[model samples]
Target: MANNQRIQLKGRVFITFNIKAVTGLHIGGTESGIEIGGVDKTVIRDPLTNRPYIPGSSLKGKMRSLLEKYKGLRQNQRIGQGYIHSCDNPEEYPNCEVCQVFGVPGERDFATPTRLVVRDVMMTDKSAQDLEVSGRTDLPYTEVKTEVSIDRVTSAANPRQMERVPAGTEFGPAELVYSLYDGDGCDVQKDIEHLRTLVEGLQLLEDDYLGGLGSRGSGKVKLENITVALRVGETYAEEKKLLDKFENLGCLVEKLKELQDQIRQHVGK
Candidate 1:
């Protein structure tokens, strides 16, 4: 009889945060989203309507907020600088780098948002009726690697500065439109501010280079897709699920734009 050694998986999870800036003239800044708070706050804007859409900056900002919670940092202030060199300190340490370089200190330049791709790895081991650690131990296990990529507008080659979309040619499905909410004039104005914040966070990265450290300036980020992957016992079920979810979300976004069009038609905005 053979005793089966339970296969344990251990590996690094390369969770990538693909940050990018906002592009597309029709959709850039003000004209896109709605106002929520004091000013107009933007959420993800519809692509086909020349309206507001959530920028990658918002996603990264939200992630940074979440990370702060995990690290028990102050809520009021922004996180450390990103992976860039703004001051001379980084040149000296060569180790303890600053955060702002990666768009931490102040709102990163609209031109470029410093994206610092960070990763953490963990391993696991199992023993077949054996134990070894400080004294003595041995273990057997299977390693599984997984990663999730949250890609934002990280690409360059600004489309915002491009010539206007041909008049009356029908903006493609990629064009975004703004949806007007049912409310008084002031109410509508408020939502606009909220929508803008989300829009400002968008940063584009190059496409040629996706993750690796060196690829930082190689390519740019585009609004084409957000891919995530996972591995489980030689089967990457999570990755498949994530991709499907991404597709579904994209579809829903399109639907939202259609709804916005209806609003524009009825209200005559």
Candidate 2:
């Protein structure tokens, strides 16, 4: 007799914040890696030797970690369970915002919709049957479209800084994304100064370029080219002609200068 495949289970209602910043920071542990030109280079660094390259796996791994941490997700113990799935501990169940939605149940673990993802979930150890896997769990989510920019130091130890997008906005999965700028966001100059103070505490070569801590032994950064352009003109007309191209090149120079300084500081040159 074919019994009905219906079983009572709980559903969770919570938000999962996706990565809006640049991806491909890891030099290992396959996520989505960056291709310098044609070849996919690892962006992580080795702890023993400092060098810069890209690691596809690293990129993906970090993203997974971020999502799991931010969402307070548990590991799926199942074999083919999807990444970012749900955890239902038949043991002492962890209280979660999503779990609360399902009401209190002692027998079954926290069950979620099954998801099929490229990589396995790294954080959880729950069974595969308990996970809700997908390429991205946000596929079914509704994005609250609002543009907000934040200006934060890209790195404290490095001169690199850029305006980042604010949190809480939903955008489709992108390799890299930034928040819109707003006055409420962190002051760019002030943030940079703060980073300067913290710079000394950081060891350049000892850190990975893209991935943060575990990636410390993954890859390194290399300075490629530096081009400086000078503009000369007193009159508005003359200045305008030279200024356009020069101004564009000048920006590149600033970035290069920052990169140069970073290399020198790290390499102790």
Candidate 3:
């Protein structure tokens, strides 16, 4: 019966925030076509604007990876060249927060709608303008950082240049859209809980790092100026702000019950 059921969209919660680069952030992109003296590693950028931006896939993947590790979930599913944790058992799909929020393989018999959508974050106009005219940036709105590695056997030093968005730069307003659903043995409760998991993932990301070169000190980020709104069921046409501008995820964490209460008040109708 569960396998034959259909899922229905109940609502969506919108989370918007700013990503402040506390340290030089590096999310590598192709190093092709650079001059001999150019950076060997480069941050990913929007093709149209040539401004380095955070890809949704990068953030979402990082969150999922962190959550999986936190939950001690098994990494059994192979995705491209990497392996990610996925609960293959349909029976367990509804119960696993990672799978419920991130989703499972399409071929799975119990495949249900994934509840989360993370959007690519772009630079704020102010940041873009500041970096553009600052004259300190090596490239457009970015800086080149050179790093060195010591060869163990040869006892030699090899230096490589990496492109990064300079510290104190901000990219936003970052957005995450979370969908609530019904049917298929799932209810709004599960979706609501998944929302909690979603927020937790973001919290995990802040403590961890974003992009590459994290271990050696890069990709440190903070989520700030967060606002959460919702559009639910009968009132789907109208967007209501559950939580007004909060400073960070920690603030939201303290108010989860209130957030849930606000959601319940709206949806219980």
Best by TM-score: 3
> TM-score for each prediction?
0.21, 0.20, 0.95
**The candidate that achieves the highest lDDT relative to the unseen native structure:** 3
lDDT of 1 by residue, 155-228 (tens): 44422111111111111122122222222211222222222222222221222222222122211233433333
Model 3 lDDT vs. the true structure? 0.86
Quantify all predictions' global Cα lDDT against the true fold: 0.27, 0.27, 0.86
The residue-by-residue lDDT of candidate 2 on 1-95, one tens digit each, is: 01332322111111111122122123232325544432222223333333222233444344334444545566554434454434455333333
- Of candidate 1, the 10-residue stretch with the lowest lDDT total is 137-146
Off by over 4 Å in 1: 1-52, 74-101, 105-113, 116-269
Per-residue C-alpha lDDT of model 3 across residues 1-269, encoded as one tens digit per residue: 23567877777888999999999999888877888878898888999998889999999999999999999999998989999999888667767999888877777777787778899999888999999889999888888888899999998999988889999999999999988888765688767766788888989999999999999899999999999988887778775656556898899988887887777676662
